[model samples]
Target chain A: MPTDPKNPSGASTINGTDAVDSRRKPGAAEKSWEEKTLVPTLAKSPERASKFTTVSSYPIRRLYTPADLSGWDEDRDLGLPGEPPYTRGIHPTMYRTRLWTMRQFAGFGTAEDTNQRFRYLLAQGQTGLSVAFDLPTLMGYDSDHALSEGEVGKCGVAISSLADMEVLFDKIPIADVSTSMTINSPAAVIWAMYLAVAEKQGADWKKIAGTLQNDILKEYIAQKEYIYPPEPSMRLVIDTIEFGAKHTPKFNVISISGYHIREAGSTAIQELAFTLRDGIEYVDWALRRGMNIDEFAPRLSFFFNAHSDFFEEIAKYRAARRIWHKTMTERYGAKNARSWALRFHTQTAGCSLTAQQPYNNVVRTALQALAAVLGGTQSLHTNSLDEAWALPTEFAATLALRTQQIIAHESGVTNTVDPLGGSYFVEALTNEVEAGAWDYIRKIDALGGMVAAIERGYPQREIADAAYQYQMEVDRKEKIVVGVNDYFTKENPLDILQIDESVAHRQAERLAKLRAERSSDEVARRLDGLRIASQGKENLMPYIYDAVKAYATLGEICDAMKVAFGIYDEVAIT
Target chain B: MSEKRIRVLIAKPGLDGHDRGAKIIARALRDAGMEVIYTGLRQTPEMIASAAAQEDVDVIGLSILSGAHNTLGPRLMELLREKGMGDVCVVIGGIIPEADIPALKKVGIAEIFLPGTPTQAIVDFIRSRISAAPSKA
Candidate 1:
C-alpha cells in the first residue's frame, strides 16, 4: 500500500475531487473501520479529509508526532521563557507564578452605567480593567457633536470630557489596577484624558500601569477606526512610544493587536503574520526616530483572538511568541530579554459567538478561554454569552466574568506553565503555524512591509479568501456549527439584552452642558496650539495633554487637526 | 464590451461600529459579482444618505449593531426620501429585536436580515430583487 502524497494521514486527501479517492481499490477490510465504529466519524473515508483544514485551510493531520517538528531545535528555537526565542512561553513560570490577567472588555451605555460594570468586575477578583469606548469616542467625536447623534452610548461608554472620565473611574484606584484602553486613531488624546483624570485623583504616573491600543498600523489594515492617513497616524504612534519611554515607566504605549484583525474575518495565521508585520513597522518607525528598540519593545504588548478552534488557536499564540522573539533577537539585534518576549492579551473570539442559541456561546467562550491559558497568554478578556445578540446583560456579563474566574481558580490548568508545551499535536501545530506566518512575513517584506502590502490589498485579499473558505466549509456541513448548521432548532427565543436609546440622549445632553461650562478661550487656545504643533515635528502627547486639560471636546480636537491633516479616504482596490 | 457590474454600498450607519455582520455581507455581495463599497464604522444618517446619492449605487444596505436602529433607521429613510432616492432598497441587518422590526418596516425598510441568517440567503435575495426590478430593462 502506498501513502497518498497529499494525504499526510492515511485518509485520502480530497481536493474537490469526490467523496473518496477511488483510483485504488479499497481492501475488503478498509470500509469495516467506518461501519463498525460506535460513533460516526466526521469524514469516514480518506478522500473526504479536506474538511479538517485549519481556519487558514492548511490541511491538518488527525494526529501529529515529533517527525512533524523534525527541524526544531530546543535551544535555538524553543528557548527558556523570559529569554530569546521564547517559544515554550513568555515568562519562565507563566501562569504557575501568576495566572493570566482576567481583563474583561467592560463598557457600554453611559459613563455612569459602564462605571458600575467596571467596579463590579474589579470587585469580583478581576485584576485589570479594559475600557470599551463608544463609536463616538473611538471615531474622535465628543458625545454632544451633531455627528455623534444617536450613537453616544450605543456600542460602548460615552466619554465627552474630563468630567465623564473622572466619573467613569470615580472610586477605582487607577494606581493599583492595570487598565487597557482599546483606542487607536485618537489614542494620544484619550490617553491624555485618562492621564488628566489620574492626576486629579492624585495618582502618580510612574505607579499606574495600563495599555493604550495605540497601534495605528492594524487600524489601517483591519480596524478602520483611523482618523488621519498612515503617515500622521504612524507619527502619533511613535509619539506615544517615545512619550511612554520618557515618562510613564509602567505604561505600555501600545498593544499591537491581532484581535481586531481576527475579528475582521482574518485567519489565525493571517492575524499572526499581519500583526507581527505591524509590530515590526512600529519598531521601524521608533528606530527611525532614533529610539532604541529595547527601550519601548518590552512594554510593546499584543492582543489576540482566542477562536473556537482550540488546538489551532493555541498553536497560533505559541508561534506568535517564537516568531516575535526570533525576529527581535536574531534580526533586530535586541539585547534585552524583555524585548524578545511577546507579551499578549487575548479575548475569546467575538465572531465565533452565534446569535442562535445564545447560551451555547458560554460553552464556546469557556473553551476558547481555556485554550488561551494553555496557549500562554499574559492577559485575557472572555466574551459574554449574550454579546453576539446585543451588549451583554448584567447576568450574562457576570457569567462571562465567572467563566474566567473558574478557569483561573478551579481548572488547575494555570497551576502549571504552558501545559500544552510538549504535546506532539500542539508542538507540531505550533511549528506549522510559525512556518505559515513566516512565509507570509517574507512575502510582506518583499512588498516592503505592512504599509505597502496594505496599499496593494494583499493582507485584505488573503483574509477575504480565508473567510470565504471558512464560510464554504460551514455551508458544506464539513465544519459543523452546533447551533447554526448541525443542531436544527425551530424558533427558540434567545434572551437578548437591550440598551435603551435614551442612554445616548442623556449622554448628548451631558456633553452639551460640559461644553457650555468650559472656558471657551482655553479650548480655542489649546486647540489652536495643537494645530500649530501638528505642523511641526513635536511629540503630540504634550499637545494632546494640553488640549484635554483645557476640556476641548473630542470632536473639536479631532476636527481642528483633520483640517490640517486632511481626512483619509481609502483608494479602491486595483 | 464590459457590462456594468452591480455596484452596492454597504454602510454601518449611526455609531454602530460592530461590523462583523456587515463585513461578511460585503464580502459575500462582492463574491456574488457585485462591486461592494463598505464605509467602515460610525456613519451618520446624513452621511449615509449623501453617500447613497453620491455613489449612485444599486442598493444601500444599512448595518446597525447598535440598538439605535429604531431612531437611526427612520432618520436615514427620511433623508433618503428628502433626497428623492427612496427607491434604494435599504436592508437592515444586525440584532434588531423582533418587536422593533415592525417599527423599522413602518419607516420604509424593504427587508431585515437578522444575525442568524446565512450569507448565501442574502446574496440570493439581493440578486432576485435586483433582477426582478422593471427599471433594469
Candidate 2:
C-alpha cells in the first residue's frame, strides 16, 4: 500500500467528526434515529456537509451520484458480473443462487490432531477445508527440527509429510470438499501433500481441488516467510499456476492475501492496495513465463481481512473488485471476464481481538463478519471469541461458526444484491479506497511492479509508517479503542481459552509413530525423484505428489530445494 | 554520563515469525534515539541469546506470538542467567496471558508489555530500565 505523506495512517485523514466520540455524547450515541439530527449529513447536500469516511480515514462524500464517480464510464468501470471488468462479482447471483463457501480455518498441534479437527469441522457442516499450517511449516522446517521444537503446531497444524496431511484429511473427502491452505513459503510442497492425499484416495489430479496462499510477495512485506529469493519464489508460483491451468482447472493456484498485511498493522487501504499489487505481480510473473493471462488468471482467488470497521470493510471490498477489474482488463489485457473478477475469501480481523475484555472480540468479530458478508465475500471465516487467548476451544469454535450462521439465516441483509452499494457513504468510501489503493498501484508501476517495489522496501516502509502513525494516534487519544486507551476497566471480565502444552508432546508421539510405520525406502526414492525433477523444468506437482505418497516429509522436499534455492531470511527493513 | 544510545535486540525466538510487534517496537525505539539491532525472523532462543551476548546489548526485546513465550521466554532468561548476563534487562511483548505475568516476572523478566501497550511506554521503559552506562566516575 502506498503511503501518502499527507494521510500516512490512512485512517486518520477524516476529521474526528465522522465518529462522534460516544464518550462525550451518551444521548446522541444511545438515541439512534430521532436524536441524531445533530450529526451533519453530506447526503442532505454534499457541498454543505463533510464527506463520509473509510476505515482508513479516506474522506468519502455523502452521495455518489454519477457526479461523485464523475469520469467512471459504466461500460468501462462498472461492468456486469462474470463479465470482463467484473466490478459487481464473479457470479451474477453471488449469494442468491449459491451461499459463499463456509470455510473456517482450523488446524493446531500435529497432523493427526489437525486431521481430527478437519473431520470435526466437516461433520459440523463446513463446506470447504482451509489449512492453517504451524509457524515451522510456514517457515519451511520439519517439526522435529531444533528450530521448530516447541513451535510444532503451536499456532497451526504441524505438517511434516504426506503422512501428516493424510492424517489431517482422513475420511474428510478431499475429492468432494474443496480445500484452501494458508501456507505461503512452503505452499507448493503443502499443496503437493494435499494432492498426494487425494491421489492415495484414488482421486485423479484433475479431480483434486484446493487453493494455496502461494502469494509470496506478502512474505517479504508482512508475513516474513520466504524460502528463496524473489526470482525462484516467482518461478515456484508460475509453476503452480501453469500446472493448475493445464490440469486441475478447478484449483485456485494463488490466493492473493491481505490478511497478514492488515494483521501486521496496515490500514484498510494498504491491505487492499498491497494485496491487489501482489496479484498484479503474480500475473506479470506468469505472463513472463509465457502462460496466457486468462488461463491462470481465472483460477486466481484472493483472501482479505474484514476489519472492525463496518462501512470501511464493505467499501474496501468494493474498491478491491473495481481496482482488480480495471488493472486486469485495462492493464493486463485480460480477455476473459473470469480473469477480471476478484473473487475473494474473507476472515474477520484477528488483529482487532483484545486480550482485555476478551468477550468483546465476539461482538467485534460479528460486526466484522457482517461487513464481510455485506461486502460480498465469496467465502468467510469468523474468528472465535477465544482466539485472542489460544487456538479456539470447541465451545469457542462453535460460537464462531454460529456467528456466521446467524448472519446468514437471521440477518436479512442478503435479501438484496449489493445491499450497501447505493449508500451515499458506501459508494463514496468505495471510490476513496480505490483511489487511495491506485495511488500505491501507480507508484509500484512506476517502480516497475511489486517485485521491484519489494526489493526497494517500498511496501514494507509504507506499512511501517502507517502502523507507526496509527499507533501515535491511538496513544494520543485521537483514536478511541474502547478497552485499550479509553473507557478501560481494570476489572477484566472475559473468558480465555487455555490449551495444554502436553497436546504438542502427544501429537509429536503420534507423528513419530506414523513415520516409523511408513516405508523409508519408498520415501527416499520418491524424494530423490523430486530432487531430480527440481533440477529440470518439469511441473513439480507430480513429483511432489510422488514424494508425498512415498511418505516423504515436507522438510525433506523443502530441504532438497533449500539446498538448491537457499532459505530467505527477511532483510531487516527497519 | 552522556545519554549513550540504548542498544536493544528485537528478536523473534521460536518460530512464530510474527515480527510486526517486534518491527513496530524497533522503529519506535529507533525513533526515540536508541540503537536497535533486529534479529530477523525464526531465531531460536539459543541463537537470540548468543546474538545478545555477542552484540552486548543493554536490552533484549523478545517478541513471541507463537504462544511458546511461556517456554521460550523462561528458557531465554535461564540462558541469560547461565551466560553471566543476568544483569541484562529482558523485556518480552506478545500474546502472553495476564495470568502468566507473575511467573515470568519471578524469573526476572524486567518487564512484560502485552499487545496494545503503547510504544512510547516501551521506549520510556527501555530508557529508564537500561542501567545508565557506568557513570565515568
Candidate 3:
C-alpha cells in the first residue's frame, strides 16, 4: 500500500485490523468466495470486458467491501452535515430545505436580445441568472474595435459598456436576482459596470448579491480569455475580493473554478486539486494584502464540471468538500465554520455533449445533472442539446432548464442528504480520489504554487497530454463515446441558433451613438484615474467604478489598465 | 531528388481561446510525420496568412470556435490570394454549423471538420489532399 504524505499518521492504511470485529473478516471471505464460487463462475462464463475504468481512466474494482476502508474512521472522514470536513453535505437539510438553484447559462446576440431570454428563463422558474458574454466583451474589446470584427455577439451577449449592461438588466430587478457573470481577465471592469447598474437602480450595495467568475489563474491554465499577466491579473482578483468583503458582503467576489479546467480536458483529480490549490493561492494573496482568512473566505465559492461517470463524479465532490475543509482548518487555520465549507455550483460537461444524435445529449445532461444533485451542488447548469453547434436556442435552453426541474421535482434522489455517503464503493472511491488530489496538491506546492506551475506550463502540458490520450482512446475504440465511436448513424442536423450578422452592425451603431453622446472628456479623465490607480497599490474597484460610471467602455477601461500592466503572451505548448 | 516532407501550419484565429481542437490536430499531424507549426491564439486573418507565407507551409488548418469562421475564413483566403499564396490547402474546424460549411467551402476552404471528427480522419484528409497537389518546392 502506498502511503499518503498528507496522512502522515498512517491513519488511512488499509491493514484490516482497525475494522470492527463483529463482522466477518471481509478480506479472507472475499478470497474464499473468489476461490469457491467466483472462480467457477468465471471459468464457466468469463468476465465480459478486459478492464473496467471510469471516464478519467481510473480503474474500477469489481466490488468494494469493508476491507477497502479498513482503517477508516467514519466520524473523522465523513462528518455530519453542516459540520467540519463537510464530507456529506454543507447544510443539515440539504435539498429538503432548498432545492439547488437552477441557473442555466444564457447569453447571445445583443444585450437586449439576451435580456429577453433572461426574462423568459426567470418566468420559466429559473432561480438565478448566469450571463455568458460574447468574445468581444470577454476579451475587453468594444463592438466597434478592429479585433472585435465578426465576434461582436457570436458566442454570447455583447455588453460593451454600462449602457449595454443597463439594457441587459432592463425591467429585471437586479437587487433580487443573484447574477453570475462568466468573465475572467475583464471581470473587474464588468463587475464594476454591474455594480454601477445596481446603484442606478437605487439598490443598496450591501443588499445586492452575485458572483463574478474572476478566477484569472484558470484563464492562463485552461480558458484563454486572459488579457493581462499573472501578477497584475491576480492583483485585480484580490482587489475584488477585498472590496467585496468590505462592501458587497452578500456577493461571491470570485468563483474559483474547476469547471473550465475539466472542460479543458483534465482528470477529475486534476480539476479538484488545481481548483483547491487556486483557492489557496487566492487566500495567500488576500492574506498578503493584510486580510483575515474568515473575512473573505466565506464568500469564496467554487464551480465544478459534472461530467459522466456517476460514482467518480460523486466521489470527486465528496473529496472536494473534505479536502477543502481540511485545507481551510488545518492549513490556513480558519476559525469560522462557513469558511471551511466548500460551496460549489456545477455545470454538466459541455465537452461530453455529442454533435451526432444531438438529442442523446438530453439524456447525458440528465444523468450528469443528477450526479451533481446527488453530490450536493448548490446550483447547476445543464447544457442544451444543440450547444455543440451554436449557443442554445430558446426551445433548447428551456428544455435544458426543464432537465434540472425534472431532476429536482420528479427524481426521488433529493429526498435525503448525501444519499450515497456511506456506500462501500463510494466511501472507498472518495478516499482514493482525495488521496490522488492530495498527491497532485503536493506536486503543485513543490512547484511553488499554481501561478509558478502555470508559468512553467506544468498543468498546461499535463492537460494537453490527457486530452491527447483521451482522443487516442476514442480513436482506437478502447473508449467509446456513444454517438461518435459507437452507435453510429447519419445525423439530420437540427436547427441551430444563429447570431445574425446584423448584431455586429447594431452593436457598432449603438457604440458609436454612445461615444457621440457621452462626455468623452469625463471618460478620458476617469480612464486616466483608473490608469493611475492601476500603477499604485490602491484597490482598483473604486477606480473601476468611477470609470464605469463615467460611461467608459469596457475596452477603454481595460486599455487604461493595460497601459500600466502590459499584455500577457502565453507560452503555448502542445 | 529527395521528396520534401509535408509542412502544415495550425493557427487559432479569433478572440476566443478554444484551442483544444487546434492543439490536438496539431499534435495529430505532427505524429503523422508532418512538420507542424502552431500560431497559438488570437491571430487575425492577416497574421495567419502572413505566418503561412513566412513559414512556407503547404497546408493551413484554422480553428475557430468563436463563430467568427464565416468572416475570418474568407478574409484569410483573400489575403492568401493577395499574397499569391492561394495554392495553400486550407481546412477549418470547431463548432461550425452545417449551413455555413458550403459557403465556407465556396470561399476556398478545402474542407470543414466539425466536432467529433477523428484525428485520423483529419490526418488522412490532409495527407491525401496535400500529396495530390504538385510540390510547391
Candidate 4:
C-alpha cells in the first residue's frame, strides 16, 4: 500500500506513520503474493504447461502489473489521441467518426473476369479496391510470354497493357474510389498504365487517391519479386516519390510494407523493425534526390499484417506509431505533423490460415480482423477462409467482408478511442516491442541501412531462422495450432475457385489484338526514349507513362529498363 | 562401410516468391544429414532441370505455389527425361489441391505435400522413398 496526496479518500493510507513512507512498493507486494499465495496453489496443483509463450515464441509472464511499467511516463510515452508520439491513436475520434475502409484484395482471371468480381465486392459494401495482379504481371511479363505458362490469371488478374487496365476499371469512376495496387517489380510501368486509364477517364491527376505497393526493398529481403538490382530499384522508388509529390498529391507513392515480410515468416517485432527501417531507407534516398522531407513523406504510407496473438499485434501497431513519430521529427527533421503520423492498412495474416478444416479459418480471420480494428488500422482486408486452398470464391470473400462489418456495426469495441491505452500489459508490451525493434534498427544501421543490410543477407537470414524455429516448435508440439498440430480431425476439402486454362488463351488473344491494332512505330519510338532515359538520372515515370500511352506491353517497358539495369540474382540461403 | 547420404536439390519453378516452405524444407533436409542445393526464386523449368543435372542430385524437390504445377510439373519431367535424368525422384510441395494431386502423380511427381505438413513427415517420406529405390549414383 502507498499513500497518495491526490487520493482525497485516503484509500492508500493504511496507517498514520507518514502515510506514503509506510507503504510497500508494488514489487515487494507482488513478491510476497507470489510466495505466500501462488506457491501454495501451484504446489497443490501444477500448472497446465511448463512454460507459456506467444506465437513468436517470446516468453509470457504469469501476470503484468504496475511493477512491469516502472519507467513509463504517461504524458511522455503516451499523450492524448491525435497528438505527439500517437501511441493512443492517430485521430482523436478514431472509429466513432468514421469506420475503416473495407478493402478486400480480389483478383483472379482476365481483367474482364476480375472486373466483375470487383463490381460485386463494391456492390456488397466494399469501400475501397485492392488489385491483386497475377504472377506474370507481378514479374513484369505479358500473358503471352513463355514464362507466363499456367500462371496467366491463376493468382490474380492479368494486366498486360493499358488496354487491360482500362477493362479492369471498366465502369468504375476513378475519381470517387480509392484503389490500391499490389504490384512491386514493375510498379512504375503498371502505375503508368493506371494513370493512363485515369487520364482517359478525365480524372485529374492531383485528385486521384490510392497506394502503390512500390516497396522493392522488401522484395529483396522477403518477397523476392525483384527485377532490377537494389541500386537501380531504389532509384526507381525515389523517382516515383519525387514524381508523386509533384503530381499525384493524394496518392501514396510507396506503401512500405511488412505484410509480405511477415507472410514470408518473420516475428512481429521483425516485421515492425524492418518495415520502419525500410521507410527510413526510402526517406534517406528521397533526401539524396533533393526533395524536402515534408514534400513526399506525407504520402509514404505503410502496410502491416494483423497476425494472431491479439495483444502482441495491438502492441506492435502502437509501437509502430511511436517509433515512426520519433524518427520523423527527431531523426529526419520533418516539420509537417502529417509526416510524423504513421497510417497503415492491415490485412489478416494469410500464413495463419489452414488448408485442413478450412471453415475454421473464418474464426481465425474474424479474430485477426478484430485485432486490426483494435490496433487502430486505417484500412483492413480480411482474408477469406479458402485462401489457403486458392484464391477466394465469391461466397468466401463475402463472408470475410461480413466479418469486418460485424466488428464495425455489432462490436461495441469501436465506440471509444484506444480503449486498451491504459492497460498494464499492453503498455508494457508496447515498450518492450519498441525496444526490440530499436535493437534491430541499431544493428541494421551498423550494417549501413536496410539496402546494404539486405545485400548482406542479414534480415533474410534472421527471418529464415525465425521461420525455421517456429516450424520446429510446431512440430515438437510446443505450439498448438488448432486443427493443424492438435485437435485433429479429418474433413472433406473445400471447393476452391479454379482458373480455367482458357484464361491464358483468352489473354494471349487479347494481347495479339492490341499489338495488331496499336501503332508499331510509336511503340518503338517511345520504348527507345524510355531505354535512353533509363540510362540517365532523369525521372522515369513520364517515360514509362509515354510508353504505356502508346500501348507498349508491360514486359516491353520492363525489358527496356532491363537493357540499362541488369537483372538481380540473389544467392539462395537456407 | 560408410552409407551414401541423400542429395536433394530444392528448386522454385515459375515466378512465385513464396519460398518460406521451400527454404524450411531445404533446411530440414540438410539437418537430416542430406546435401541440399537451393535454386533461388524465378527459376524456369529448363533452369531447374539443368541445375538438377549440374548438381548431380538424386531427388528434385519442386516448389510451385502459383498453381502452375499442372504445366510446370509435367514440363520439368519431360526436361529431366530429355536430360537422361528420368530416374530422379521428383517431388512437389505447395498449395496443391487434393483433386490435382492425382494428376500430378500421374505426371511422375512422387509425392505432393500441402500446407500444415510437419517437417518430420517430409523428412521421413524422402528417406523411405529414396532408400526403397535404386541409387542413381
How many clashing pairs per prediction, in order? 2, 5, 0, 0
Ten-residue region with minimum lDDT total, candidate 1 chain A: A13-22
- With candidate 1 superimposed using the best TM-score fit, by how many Å does residue A112's alpha carbon deviate from the native? 1.2
- DockQ for the candidates, in order: 0.42, 0.62, 0.81, 0.80
**lDDT (Cα atoms) of all candidates against the true structure:** 0.80, 0.78, 0.90, 0.91
Clashing pairs in 3: none
| Candidate maximizing DockQ | 3
lDDT of 3 by residue, B1-137 (tens): 66688899999998988788898999999998899999999999999999999999999999988899999999999999999999999999898999999899998999999889999999999889988998785
Off by over 4 Å in 3: A1-26
Evaluated on the second chain alone, the candidates' TM-scores are 0.92, 0.92, 0.97, 0.96
lDDT of 1: 0.80
Q: Which candidate achieves the best lDDT against the true structure? A: 4
lDDT of 1 by residue, A28-93 (tens): 454454345412443343343434566556566544445455667777766667666677787788
Q: Candidate 2 clashing pairs?
A: A10-A56, A11-A56, A52-A60, A115-A168, A160-A554
Q: Which lDDT tens digits does candidate 3 get at residues A1-574?
A: 2223444332222222233323325677776876787666654654445446788888776667886788789999997898877889999999999999899899999999999999999999999999999999999999999999989889899999999999999998988999999999999999999999999899898999889999999989998889999999999999999999999999998999999988888999989999999999999999999999999999999999999998899999999999999999999999998899999999999999988899999999999999999899999999999989999989999999999999888888889898898899899889989999999999999999989999999999988988888888888888889889899888688998988789999999999999999999999998989999899999999999998998999999999999889999998998
Error of 1 at B49 (Å): 4.1
Clashing pairs in 1: A11-A46, A12-A46
TM-score of chain B of 2: 0.92
lDDT for model 3: 0.90
Question: TM-score for each prediction?
Answer: 0.90, 0.89, 0.96, 0.96
lDDT of 4 by residue, A1-574 (tens): 1223353332222211232223324577877886677766655655455445678876555567786678799999989999989998889899999999999998999999999999999999999999999999999999999989999999999999999999999999999999999999899999999999999999999999999999999999999998999999999999888999999999998999999999999999999999999999999999999999999988999999999989999999999999999999999999999999999999999999998899999999999999889989999999999988899999999999999999999999899999999898899789989999999999999999999999899999999999999999989878888999989898988888989899999999999999999999999999999999999999999999999999999999999999999999998778
Q: Give the CA lDDT, 0 to 100, for residue A105 in model 4.
A: 96
- Residue lDDT tens for model 1, B25-62: 88788877898988766677888889888988778888
Pairwise TM-score winner, candidates 1 and 4? 4
